[model samples]
Target: MKILYWNCCGVGNPATVREFRQLLVANVPDIVFLCETKINSNRFQRIRSICRMEGCLAVDSVGKSGGFALLWRDGIDVSVQNYSNSHINSLVRLENEDVLRFTGFYGQTASRSRQQAWDILRRVHHKVNEGWIVGGDFNAILNLSEKEGGRSKPKVLMEEFCNILEELKLTDIKPCNGWFTWTNNREGDRLVKERLDRFVASDVILDKFPFLASYVVRQSRSDHEAILIDTKGSKPNRERMGHKAWFRYDTCWAGEQELKDLISCIWEKEESNMLAKMDMTRDKLGPWQFSRFRNLKYKIKGLEKEIIRLMDGRTDD
Candidate 1:
């Protein structure tokens, strides 16, 4: 199953809605959690239908600043456990007969209100069994490296957030696709970037879905990038999802000067049209990328395995 979350920042905006719809169409997530919708309950009902989801529960905005929705597709059994302005807690029964507790959270912005947010989360967590997966904008960073281009956050604040997770027995699942989740959208030195949104789960759930991982997705607008939590795809599904058997530019290749020069030289050729140039570039990069660096990726994977073996002294999962 795939789960997606985004801090939309607005619900009434056409562009935002379009992006949201496009995401739903492309990825086909089983569950979706939206934050900062800035809409009321009645309006959210309409939005749910527009999203083409079967069931939903919403926390209406107080004025125009805060609102959220939890959505699930048909055939998934989801039960609400608890809810508040800062969160919507639920019990999810997956189709494969596994069960877990899910909480879609949006932390308060102010320091004082944020404490209340944490306190409530602690209280709710004690009521659930194992296999807990909580995710969203915590509005709190657990370390210094998670934020950039801004004044340093208070160290005590970071410690408090980390302490909460440690005590709750939750572990962070680092995202694989993007380094940051939000930006101030400001230019120059005024800009700020943060790893505010994430998914955390208890050890039992992580063990159950060993292939589960997250990818951070960015769109044209919004400071907060969306997160896609893929839990259904195992090793085979993953291979089928990727390795397209066709040529495409890997985003990671942009950082390599040799690859850049190769593309530039090919692109400068007397191309018939834009499509021809792109096809030629892809044809050239395919073999070159494989010959030089594809094996490097596998070597990195082997190194990762060695580290895991050193830590656990076992190759079996």
Candidate 2:
């Protein structure tokens, strides 16, 4: 299952929403965490429709600042565990067989005060136990190499950031590809860049799911790049609903031995009737297959919604 996370700054804007829709339609990530949405529950439906991720749960702040949300695609079976109503700290326990916990964050960027923010993260980490992923803009680099500079660190936030990582025993997943996710929009030699965005996972996550990949995509409008993670090789529970083909197309129809003869039979009846005959063939086969696919898709979607709703106790049923 592929999961993506990004601090869009504010998805409430129309242009940002349009760009997001394009990326989501192309990539089709299983789960996505959007940070700095700057939107509350009042405008979440706009985000849901624009992104097209059905059956999602969003934890929005009161105003247009420090909001974070977690969303999953329709078919995936994930149950949200122990989600409180805090704006900066949005935590969810995923009900995979391994009992995974995912916490989405938007840390404080201002100096000195970030310490309290990190403290809160550590508290949440210990409270949630091990097997979890902590991802977001920490606003503090974990190391000296994280920031672009010729001299020493500004306020030496690395030591504090590293201490947090050590305490939590979380591994930085996007070190290789993404050096700097956030950049200053200044011109000339005064340009500044920092690796503010991050995805850190516990020892259990590394040991259990080693094949999961992570990277950052370029954000067009926003200064922060979109972070994407692909959770490959993780075993999804198939026994819950049993296995069935997601989509089926007739291979037999592609290579009919007497294809010319079939067309000849239709053409002999009437020249104008040739197109109508092919249309008839499609009409007969297409609806059955398409309808079945749609029905199965809707059923899986409903099941996922039910699971999430039951776990979170927010059923409209």
Candidate 3:
């Protein structure tokens, strides 16, 4: 199943609402996590109602500026793993039996407390099981690769961030598309983009489910782009290529003309019997046969399309 994680910046704004709806429509993710909701439960309820229409159940922490939230599509078995008193963090257990730990951190803009937050993250990582995933707007860059203009400059904050990663034994799941996930709020030439949002997995988790595909999505209003990840298999290419075969439909027969004649004759005999015979045919058909049957269905569907095209002229009159 596909899962999406994003920081909406704030669902309170109309622009963010529009972008959120568009993303839900485009991706159709089974699970969605949001950071920096910037609204408490009562105010968030309205946004939750909109998301419910997309078949997602919204769970959130109370906060005014930076709150964490967990949302999942309906009919999937999920539950809250736990939540801290601080709106900075929350956790949820997904249907796949994997735990998702989210920390909606807005680290101290310019203070030693950033290091303390990183240390808390290290502790949280240690407390969680090996299969869990920890992610959010880290606020502090992990390494030089995360920053562009400041690449050459030494960043003490980033150094402390790196130490936390090492201590927790967590590694980044690099994005396949975008290099950076956040941008500075400034006009024109003064703006800078940096990779601040992140997805980290333990060594054991990566080894077990290697086919994880991670990438960043572009949304105009928010400073941060959304991160998307899928951890269903070990090899993405192989699994993606093979998935079509798993759902292929075909039909088997001694003679194509004979089968057509038989179906037509059975329909003339009795509509009920015709459906029964079709069911029997379906039951007898192997995977290859089912695939062939689907091809024939498409051929008939093509004829129906042409018929509709011809009928369109009469409707115009």
Candidate 4:
């Protein structure tokens, strides 16, 4: 399974929306966590539909800022445990029956709010009963090496970031791609870059899926680069390779009463009793998604390229 998480810096801009769609097509994540969407529910609903993800859960933007959203394709099973502006916590069941907690997280940008972020993470960590993976734009660095081309990052914040990870026993998954994951998109001395986007998970995750790896996908459309986690893929080489073999259910499905009833009904029909009710639910997920949502896996590609083609044609004309 492949998981991609990004803080697209809000998708309200027409250009940003197009770029976000492009990023989705390029990465094709089975599950996606997006931060700072800055779009209301009405608009975000349309965006998720265009992206063709059958499942979605969203935290509406507060005025013009602070929105969080999670989108996932068919075949993946996710159940949201809890959520806040800082993170959306969920349980994801892998094909191997290994269930892990995945927190699509966003740390505060302001130094004053750093303590609040840490408090939230600590609270979330207390509930971890399984392997955990927390990821997104952290907005802070562990050390100076993670930052470059910028003024010095305060040591106190770095120490705090490190301390929280240690307190939670979560370690950064090594990046096979280049180190930095965000840039100011500037030039000369004005430029700044930092490895602010990442996946840091409990060691149990590595113990369970030893081959699991995270990569820094190149950034073109946004100032922040995207992150991809391959659950059972090979090592990440300098080339940033990825392989997809299974699906993950988006936790948002658990929120809908209709889906809950449907899952309960499916759970009731099991006679073999070998597979857990959830396991049976996972079995039904694929066909359910396909039947409910058209197979738009490649639809975005065709539409995006055609739109670009027309734009180029207009430019030439």
Candidate 5:
């Protein structure tokens, strides 16, 4: 299953609506979650028809801002449990009888109301028994590394955000293509970028779909990039068939001590030819990175099982 989430800023403009349709055609996501729609339920009916989605639940925008909508194609069993301005919580049953919960979330843009957003998340979390996946524009970053060229984010706010994720046992799925998901679209010194949008999933969901991954699609009309969660993983780029894929370094890997150690180990192998050493390192890095991701998934699965066991025991009391 593939899910796409975007904070489209506003879809009232004809150009913006066209761009949205293009995205729908390109990604062909099974479900789409939209934030900051800036339209009422009546207006959203036009959008639903344009997208050709058969199922829809919309939270109308107040005056000029902060609307949300969740749309799914026909034959996808989606039952909405509850929704407010901040979130839409739903249960999805696949054709194979596997069930999962999905929450389309939008965090409060104001600092003071952010706590309220987290509270809503907690309430939704309490009701979910099956695997869960939450995605949308959170309006906040988990850490300092997520933002660039901005005044430092408040440490307390970041800590609170991290604490809630830990309490809920939700793990952020790192994006495969980019570091930042939102940019201020300013020139030179005024430019600011942050990963304000993401998808977080319970360990059960991650374990069940080991190939699952998140990707950032380039922005067309909005400040935020669209986030795509692919349950089956990314497909090979057919355009690049038989050609070597370009190797671009991800700056995020620089902070990983394991990467440093891996480089050291590769260099220590006694090959005097520098070119050969570089080739060998590239070959080894791919498998090493894959193993690290696999290991983390396994660890999450074990932790989730233990937590479930303890919760069950408590419920019996």
Candidate 6:
């Protein structure tokens, strides 16, 4: 099973909605948790249809700032336990009859009100004695190293965040892909990046699903990159023998002149057989598309390597 969490900033923009649809297509998560939707509960009906989810619980935004939505696919049994502006706590029963608690959390953005978020978490924890997994944009880093190009995070703040997790016996799951899940989108020295979004699971859940892992997905319109928690560390193979894979065109590529140029270049080649030409186009398009849109994967790999080197006390001069 897979659960995806994203702080979309807002879902009102058309571009954001398109990106959300694209994410839903690409990941096919069983459950989706969205933060900062910036829309009322009534507006989420369209989102539910887009997600193809049968279960939904939405928390309306205060004015234009904060909102939360927890959506689950058909056949999943999810019962809402408690909810507020900062979180949606649910008891989920898996197909195998195993029950677990899942919390979609949003930490207070303001430093002064941050304690309220912790207190809320504690209150929720007191009521549940089952396996638990909590995920979302905590708006706080575990340590100074989790941030870049920003004024140093306060030690007290980091300690407070850490103390809560320690008290709850929740362990942070390291993401296999991107290190930083958010960026200020500013240029040069003004830019800031941090690993604010994540998943923390109790030992009970970790022991139950030993292969569980988290991955940072590429971002499009939002500052926050989506985080996926996979109960199985690897994706299940769905390919069938003797079946040809279908290729679907993305609408987002329609406006790119480079795609037209690439097609023109392919068609201009000396192949006269129509079927062969189509096959050639498909083959060429795969690499071209990856290079165009999936370059972030390479960047993430490079960053991981650099981080490993730094942690090992080695650096290129």
The prediction achieving the highest TM-score against the true structure is: 6
Name the lDDT value of residue 148 in candidate 4. Answer: 70
Alpha-carbon RMSD, candidate 2: 12.9
* Cα lDDT for residue 301, candidate 2: 67
lDDT of 3 at 119: 61
The parts of candidate 4 lying over 4 Å away from their true place are 235-317
RMSD of each: 10.9, 12.9, 11.4, 14.1, 15.6, 7.0
All candidates in order of TM-score, best leading: 6, 1, 5, 4, 2, 3
| TM-score, per-candidate, Cα-based | 0.75, 0.67, 0.65, 0.72, 0.74, 0.76
Residue 174's lDDT within candidate 2 is: 68
> What is the Cα-based TM-score of model 1?
0.75
Model 5: CA > 4 A from native: 234-317
Candidate 4 lDDT, tens digit per residue, 6-64? 87878887787787778778777888999989888678888888778877889888888
lDDT of 3: 0.63
In candidate 6 the C-alpha lDDT for residue 58 amounts to: 91
The Cα local distance difference test for each model comes to 0.82, 0.67, 0.63, 0.79, 0.85, 0.85
Q: Give me the runs in candidate 3 sitting further than 4 Å from their true place.
A: 53-64, 84-106, 150-154, 185-188, 233-317
- Give the distance in Å from residue 69's predicted Cα in candidate 4 to where it truly belongs: 0.5
Residue-by-residue lDDT tens digits, candidate 2, 1-317: 56677888788878988988877876788778787778886687768866777756677665657676777777666666544333233333344645666776666767655766676677777676557787777777866666653345656667777877888788888643445787676644555667888788888878877777776666678888777766563356464442233223556545654544554565566655657887654444444445434586789768856643432231132
Global lDDT of model 2? 0.67
Summed over model 6, clashes come to 0
Error of 2 at 167 (Å): 0.5
